[model samples]
Target: MAYHRRYSRPGTNRTPTCDKISEILGSADKLAGEYSFGGRADTLPPTPGLFVNGVGMILLPLVSEHAKKLIAKCRQSRDRPNMDMGKSWLQSDQVEMKNPSWQAGMEKLMKNIARGTGYMDIHFTACLTN
Candidate 1:
């Protein structure tokens, strides 16, 4: 069985639940939110289990979104960063430090997606990021 979770969400990881969640996820089989294993907070299937076979298929939506000009341009920082509590903003480095669980989940997701697309020649590399 496999489990998947996304870390990049608003107000997510505000509390340091990563360690505890990792512990529980490692040992517990009857988990509450194991997505790949079919556990979900919502009863509905998380995804329709559609099989996507190519990298182009995955990139189409992202390219379409970008072409639509949906993404906002970032303002320049001059010793002033946006600090609205309701807003989520960070650089790549900050995201790695502040939202490690999300980063790990993203890495796992990318690996899975690559494998699913049949375009990946994966070699498992063991290393420590932190």
Candidate 2:
């Protein structure tokens, strides 16, 4: 007579329990909301599994929205220092400091310096120049 085992193979029962499924769905929804607003409250509802991977789904849309807001804020902060420096440069009659190309170049140079790969000749020129 052949023996029948009560336990099945690992792949035979790949489905998760209903409670586990609910927990996973909840966690995903929470992460989506937190990512959307930089750790803010989540307002979106739990996504149905069938439509979860569709266009404008949980991850992409939320991340995109968050990125847009963060980028805008960064731009504003970046411009503020330039504006202040521009005013000072104007007072000193050195209007070149207000040039857009110069500012862009300076920003790039500063980023390079931050990465420790910038030119040594480019010394720190100001106390507060972003």
Q: All models: lDDT?
A: 0.38, 0.37
- lDDT (Cα, 0-100) at 8 in candidate 2: 40
What does candidate 2's lDDT look like per residue over 1-130, in tens digits? 2122233456676345644655655555333322221222222223322112112222334577644443343323433565743332111121123224544555544544533432335554322232
| Predicted structure 2, TM vs. truth | 0.19
**lDDT of candidate model 2 versus the reference:** 0.37
- In candidate 2, clashing pairs total 0
Query: What is the per-residue lDDT of model 1 for residues 1-130, given as tens digits with 9 covering 90 to 100?
Result: 4233424358765345765565566544443323343223332223322222221112323566443332232223434455553222223221112233534554665565445444356643333221
TM-score of 1: 0.24
Give the number of the best model, judged by TM-score: 1
